[model samples]
Target: MRLLLKNTKLLQTKEQLQTCDVLIENNRIIAIKTDVESTTADQIIDCRGNLLVPGFIDVHVHLREPGGEHKETIETGTKAAARGGFTTICAMPNTNPVPDSIDRVENLHEKITADAKVRVLPYASITTGLQGETLSPITELAKQNVFAFTDDGVGIQTADQMLSAMRLAAKAGKAIVAHCEDNSLLHGGVVHQGLASERLNLPGISSVTEAVQIARDVLLAEAANCRYHVCHVSTKESVRVIRDAKRAGIKVTAEVTPHHLLLNEEDIKDADANFKMNPPLRSEADQEALLEGLLDGTIDMIATDHAPHATEEKALGFLKAPFGIVGLETAFPLLYTNLVKTKKVSLRQLIDWLTIKPAEAFQLPYGTMEIGKLADLTLIDLNSSEKIDKQKFYSKGKNTPFEGWKVFGIPKLTVMEGKIVYNNL
Candidate 1:
């Protein structure tokens, strides 16, 4: 099959918005030029001057397959990812019957190959069952197609265990994605330790819990020569720690969620569970620090941490609800509307953060639009505006705090491997 996409703007290049055409055949981009007539291709799409960028990649996402399918399955999750303009997403290991062994990861890989609408990379757990006790079969599972090793829901408590895992992961040539948190410091905290926590009378989760753990892991990663990545960073101190680690030549990378960047504790006006997440919304100062980090390259990329839970589970109010909200379908629009449109960052930089930066960090091959590369791309209408509606979401979980927010940069079409997987145009 052949597809020709015409009349679109390129995001990475400095070229002006023109009537460019991208030709694809046999799942690869064959040519990119201007004034290519539509009669030469099997199919042609008039992009209507939309921005044609490389398909987005999310390094942190929870597919909830193999056990928690009621919340999200591989098919539904990947479909949602495609709709959000993502061609590749790395699945976390915190599922029922955790992906801690070679057999488990193998099974998950088979499921992905059979059902995923886009590329689905799976992670193996650092600790068996995510219990933070004995180590899992990291060496064996890393030999498979696993993207990395992580215990995303729970942090590895013991330094020795984390160090050993880092050594093994380094030897296997795999990255160690960490969820930085100290359980002892949590103190049954449910929200960020700030003014909103005080106003809501909710237990507060201090920044020290996340910052201290990141500091420890950076030292261990440097000693072991491991590629370390911090997940869902939310605090000012954590950003400072990551920045210093990068300055000292430590191989550490960090990701921030859209919610953490756009919303703060001051935005939380109710006890709704949609506003809750593991690394809860922080103070205005923390939000400012995070934006600074993004502007200065202290934060590496933007990820959704696209966790989903059932309606009944999320309806349990803020204090007792689960620590997650659906993000895959909302990440790009929210970031583009709040960050790029507000002049805090440029459109090119935002595109790189979602595409090239993540691909560089994880060593993936699907973030560019060069010829001979996989034909994965997203066509976005940057001028149009839409009010977010949760009922129109493709994923099973519709828990989002930005439901009524007006946003720009809607994804009109998504192409994976030269095939049209989703078309909202």
Candidate 2:
């Protein structure tokens, strides 16, 4: 089959936007030029000056399947990713079965093969059952094609345990993705250890909890020569550690979530659960450092740590509620409207963070608009504006903090392997 995307705008560079037509045959882009009107087969889409770019990629997301199905599933999560212009997403391994063994990894793969609407790369837990007491079968699970090993949702407690995992992962040629948190320093905190926590009279989560762990792990990673990745980085101290590590030639990469980039502790005016998240919204100084990291290449990519919980669970309020919010359906619009439109970040750089940078960090094959590349694409109407309505989301989780916020850059269509997965055109 052949598919034609006519009159779409492509960002060829930071300052250059080109108008062109793209032609795809089967699952590969066959031609891209001024006109592909003469080439015809299955169908054609008139993009009408919309932006056609490589599909977005999210390196960090929680699908909550095989264990937390009531919150989300492979089918529903990928559908939400499609609507958000993501053609690929990596699933965190904080599920019921944990996917620590080859058998368990195979079981998760079966679910993805049968139910996923977009590419779903699953991670195997770094430690057995994510207990942090012992390492999982890292070498064996790596051979099974797990994307990476992570003990997400909780940090590996000891430096010895993390070093051992990193050594095994380095030998296995796999990345060791970490959730940096020091339980000893948490102090039973629920929100950031700042003015918000003081004003709300809630226990505070200190920035030291995250930064101290990262500082230790980077040294361990350097010693073990492992590809280490940090998840949902939110603090200036954490950014300083990561930046210093990168400067010192440590093999490290990190991701900052959209929530961290756009929102801060000051936004938490009340006890609303929607604003709650792990590595909670921090001070404005921290937010500024995160942006600086992204701009200077210290931060590698932008990922939506898209965690979803039941509405009733979140209704418990910030103190007792879960630490997460749904992000897959709102990342693009929120960033584009708040950052790009506000001139804080250029459109080209934003696209790179969402698409190519994540792919490069993880070594994925998607996220480029070139002839002969796989036809995974997204068409977005940059001129259109709409209010973010949680009720209209395809995700089973509607716990976004951006609810009712006006935004632009709505995705009109998402195509994976030359097949339409989402269409609002």
Candidate 3:
């Protein structure tokens, strides 16, 4: 099958946008030029002079399948990802049967093959059952083609256990993706230890809970010589730690969520559960640091940390509700409106954070636009504007904090492997 995308703007460099036409045959991009006339194709799309770029990739997301299907299934989660202009997403291994074994990994793969609407890369848990006491079968699971090892829902408790897991992951040639939170310092906190928590009269989660573990893990990763990736980085100290580690050549990379970059503890004026999340929204100072880190190459990419929960669960109020908010459907628009449109970050930089940066950090082969590359792309209408309505979301979870916010840069179409997965044009 041949698919043609006409009159699309392509980013030629960090500062250059070139209007061009892209032609795809089967799943590969076949041609890209200023114009292609009189070409025969099974399908043709006039992009209306919109931006056409490589599809966004999220390295951290929770598709609660195999057990928590009431929240999200592989099919629903991936459809949400497609709607968000993501062609690829990494599934966190925090499901019921936890993908800690090769058998579990294979089982999850079967579900993904049967139901996924877009590319889904599954992660293997670093600790068996995510208990953080015994290590998972890293060497065996690595051979099963899992993307990486991470006990994402919880932090590895002990330095010895983390070091051991890092050693095995290094030998197995897989990255150790960490959720850095020291439980001892948690103090049963729900929101960040700041003005919001104090005013709301709630227990507070300190930034040290995240930074201290990061400080320890970077040393362990250096000793094990393993590729280390920090997930949903939300603190200024965490950014400082990751920045210093990269400068010291510790083989470390980190990702910030759109919420972390856009919202902060100050935004949580009430007891709204939608604002609740692991490593909860931090202070504005931390938010500024995260953006600085991204600009300076300290933060490698932007991921959604797209955790979903049932509507009732999120409605339980902040203290009783679970720690998560759905993100897969609103990520691009939120970032584009708040960061790009406001000139805090350029459009090209935002695209790189969503597309090439995550791919490069994970060593994946799906984040470039060129002849012969896979035709996984997104066409975005930068001039379009609308309010984010949760009722129209494809995701099962409607827990986004950006609900009803006006935003631009809506995705018009998403093509994955030469097939149109989403179209709003």
Each prediction's whole-model lDDT (CA): 0.92, 0.93, 0.93
Off by over 4 Å in 2: none
Q: Model 3 — which ten-residue stretch has the worst lDDT?
A: 35-44
TM-score for each predicted model, relative to the true structure: 0.98, 0.99, 0.99
Clashes of each: 0, 0, 0
Model 3: residues >4 Å from true position, as ranges?
none
| Candidate 3 structure lDDT | 0.93
Better of 1 and 2 by lDDT: 2
lDDT (tens digit, per residue) of candidate 1 on 172-286: 9999999999999999999999888999999999999999999999999999999999999999999999999999999999999999999999988979889999899998989
The top-ranked prediction according to lDDT is: 2
Candidate 3 local lDDT, 52-72, one digit each (tens): 989999999999998999999
lDDT of 2 by residue, 1-425 (tens): 89898889988765577899999999999999988765475798888999998999999999999899999999999999999999999999999999999899999999999999999999999999889887898999999989999999999999999999999999999999999999999988999999999999999999999999999999999999999999999999999999999999999999999999999999998999999999899999999999999999999999999998889899999878989999999999999999999999999999999999989888899999899999999999899899999999888898988889999999999999999999999
RMSD of each: 1.0, 0.9, 1.0
Work out how many backbone clashes candidate 1 has.
0
